[model samples]
Target: MHLDKTPATRGLPRERPVLLAYLRWILLVTLVAVASACALSWALHHPSFESEIRVLVEPAEPRVGAAVAPDMETERQVAISGVVTAAAAQQVGVSATYLQEHASVTVPAASTVLVIQFDDTSAASAQRYAQAIADAYVDYRKGQAATLSAASMPTAATTPNYPVNGAAGLALGLIVGVGSALLRDRSDDRLRGPRDFVERTELPILATVPVRRRRWRRASLLPVLRDPSSTAGEAYRQVSGKVERAARQRRKLTTVTLFTSPSASDGVAHVAANTAIALAQSGHRVVLVECDVRVPRLAGLFDIPSGPGVARALVGRVPLNQALQASEVENLSLLPAGSPGPLGPGELFTFGAVGRLLSAIPADIDHVVVLTPPVLDAAETAVVAEHAHLLVLVAVIGATTRRDLEGAAAELSGGPSSLFGGVLLKAGRGGRAARRSQPLPAEWDDDMGPTAPEDDGVAEETPGTTAIDRRGRA
Candidate 1:
């Protein structure tokens, strides 16, 4: 009946379940990224073994006066120079360019020492090349005193540490996975909840009926008569009351309200049927019309014995009164969407029907609720909108999308129909007990038509109310 704040101020989604809808996707992405990165690192990386050999160095001749300190930095550079590398390559029977590419030199601080290091894929080759380079460097400095002191053979390569590499891969995977999830969340078109739907469409909320469970296909979800004490049932009652109030606010008498959705399976038909029942339960004379000729559900909804309905009446095969069947609910007449003739369902609704049908309905009827197909899916839905005084869009959370809502809003707003705001199919555990306690009609499957329970034609009504006849007359 009321609306939250405007869309301009809304950012984060309000519901916890809706916000976490795509959590599995994020976890999957992270897992796959981690596995792939680890696999690639293991496959593409090659280990490099390094070996080191140290040597002592001194001036070749004794100093005449004070002993000048040797320039170890300069000595370090000379050890790996072209001349020493060429000699080392000859000693190791390898090319000088190859030896130079794999060789490096360093010196200890404040000492006459040089350390020669070489790297290779083979550990033995690294050790041999390192020793050869030190021997050659000692030979190259003929005037200096140099002697090979010690050599350390490599046990393993330092380049490919599996633990470190795995940790890095994990960090990268987390970053990419979380970033992808965040970006997708911002651009996701699926409706999160009432606030998200309201934000995108900028339409007032008529009512929010709780959905205990999600269904792959449209199942039996009508709750007004199924369990009037339950949360879902009360919500439907709220929907009906708000709708009539909306019609009165527009100052319209005998208002014809159309219930629709942006896409199919949003439970628009179910909502419309329940709303009509709820209205009639509150003592309003109501006529429920199944205008969605393409996929008519109302004919089987109340187990109307497969008789003629609106489709046959529209094409003149039967009179509109014959198409109208009285439901079990008091004061409620149901006009089912009967099978179409040669004209086809699409052309039937889009071209013409509602104007003639309205003329046939009795003037005493206070509310006429027309259930129509989705706006985006069927062209006739917009055409049907042209005949109604109020339009109610049913939006199912986590199923109806933002783009579809915006599109539906554009289509309905452009028409002559008065916007009656939107109804949100809220998700919660409050209705779980109701759904379990109320038996779902086995007949209700993909068709979404649930039959009334078997009962004798008897009344347990108040003394003032009269019995409902087949023609919806007392």
Candidate 2:
């Protein structure tokens, strides 16, 4: 678990897409809402025209020796009273209830003025109602006047105002869209893309396997063997190339790479199996060892029996050769976990046992890919990590979390293993299990020597004789 010293950037370039994806959804929702509101407004909307009349009030001619004072409040109240409205409605040929609902009267502060406003569907009708109200108020005022008198007549009406503003609606929509996007980005904890993993862990990405939609009957555990010409097959080849490059950098003839994940169901088994097959197809002798004793799957993956595997050999019940089984692939062999004994995995995968197991591998084998239990779940994996020369971490794109990756790395670093790199699996749609027909590139073909002889499906053990051939042949 070698943590990269490179200052981990807060957000990598690749992670931009996650925010963008959220933004897209947010904008879509906002657009739909705005469109719906606009539609509703249009369907239920009623256009109304408004007219206003401002009239002046003055004190009546003062009596020769008597003082006369005018009260504007009283005049304003009288202008909008039921009596005036009823008279106005009768003159305008409309119901008093309608006039009361659509017309209002107010007085400008510190002035003897009454403002009468009318609203209707037609501009001419609004104007007529306003004039009628003014006339009715004046006639009533003349009858009751002792000091105050109506002075100025009503003025002409002004232009009507539109109720809805498109710019404001657009602005509100934008705000909602951006807020939703940010909220979603903040609340989501799952890793969205490769860039997020890169930024959080600062680990080199070995490969990215796309997400595949498969029919149940067509699905196979071994992608390299089942379908070799699809995108998934090509991805495995790329992983093999990376592994080979790492081996070359270390300058080791026999490289032991352990594949593990932060947790189970992260496709660690699938990656390990396919990688081994890919290396074998590249003309290298490869052995896939299943160390996940708790739940061994390599035997089922290769359709081989679980007996006489690594567990039997480790306990000295069977020799390494007796436990080794040939696979359907040309140069790959399987060493299953075999049946569990009374001892738990923690007790069985002791450092000494792992070292002995590694030392006993045939000298001619180019690569030994071991599939181990998830690091976070099994302490035994720490023991396995101590013996492995390189560690490969597999993580499902959307399923793995930053905490899981960090925890796994911390666990690996706590032991003796160094992180070689990481593999991003199930990245997006269009992933399938398949094999590629193209051969390794010339530069990457350093280990493209003669392949080991095929296994005859029988294990032989003899004194002073190696169980597996030095050239990786059974």
Candidate 3:
């Protein structure tokens, strides 16, 4: 039931997350394809060498008075005939069927010339087979007007074409890689990119907290207290400014801003902590209340002693004023959700307890930031709706999905308070599926309503209307 000890930090990831995960998937697939291609190309065929002989056929000159043409086609067929193959096999020390399979013959067009060729796995065997076949064909055609016009010569072994093989590999890799990348992009439920976030929610982002680069800065969640000039620190100050500006527009003397999330691990705790410190740094009297008693984090966050706070005040064990604690930061007070007894979720929020808690704060305080549990998981949101003037949602880019955010926004729509704005964490990488996944589908029933975010960030003016609407804030 305690929130302070829960330690899932969505700000940083252990490996490549979000958009980087998609890129890594593509790279891995492409590399495998290329390596396979290179290996197959080298092992595709064995070294081969070949020798060829040309035989010229001419009509007999003195056999008859009339002119005659030599039958080159018959001469070409004779080169790989059974008798010639049998004799060649004897000379080459191979079977007649093997010699026939390796031998080939062709007649040159418009010429009385026949070409004989042979191939073998080994370079020396290939040349020997070719010469033996050619010699045997010439011997078999001794009565004909055929002559060995060209001598047989062995050629060098052919080499594999590295460039052509490499090009083919590249083409195949790209096709597979691009196709895989597109398929992943579609199924991923996370915010796709910075543009995707704006298009999906349409809510005005109060602040975009960038990821931390240094280890120590990452270790300290309250960057505003440590280094207000840093990028992350400044973003929280911007959040405080937006909250104050929104409150001024409503003309409220004291603003109670509740920062909640759709899930337990959306970096909401860090955001709530730093924003209160940022407001304090700007010289505004701010009281940061940890109302998320189920998983109280403020005590562990500030290293403050955990006793006699919200839980005590809720049961009348201590005066509300006595439960408030002074923080190290000036102009800021911390009220941690201290040790709890048997109590229901609705106690602190009901019977005007919320109003009395607000009234108990010193009159000089400018703002009260309450850190509450996730909207979808907690029932107190409907009750605290009356106390919190401005409601800000904190969503993480890589760890929160579109479906979850929409559901929280819809549930919060039933509230009496105005939907002020939202905060985006880890804005650098998005639009990828990593730690976040789509919520389980709710069963179709009569009481179920449409669960989706409003394209227009305007809550309807009509009461009991269920939609996420930030009317003037858009």
Q: What 10-residue stretch in candidate 2 is worst by lDDT?
A: 436-445
Expressed as tens digits, the lDDT of each residue in 203-301 for candidate 1 is 777777776654522333667877788777888888888877765665544767899999877777778999999999988899998877666677666
Q: List model 3 lDDT by residue over 233-336, tens digit each.
A: 88899999988776667654567788998876666667888999888887889999877767666776776776677766655567767888888889889888
TM-score of candidate 2 to 2 decimals? 0.68
- Please give each candidate's TM-score: 0.70, 0.68, 0.76
Q: Write the per-residue lDDT of candidate 2 for residues 250-354, one digit (tens) a residue.
A: 665687789999987676777899999999999999999989877777766666777667665665566777778898898898898876566667766776666
Superior candidate under lDDT, 1 versus 2: 1
- Each candidate's lDDT (Cα)? 0.71, 0.69, 0.67
> Distance from true position, residue 184, model 1, in Å?
5.0
Ordered list by lDDT, greatest first: 1, 2, 3
Arranged by TM-score with the best first, the candidates are 3, 1, 2
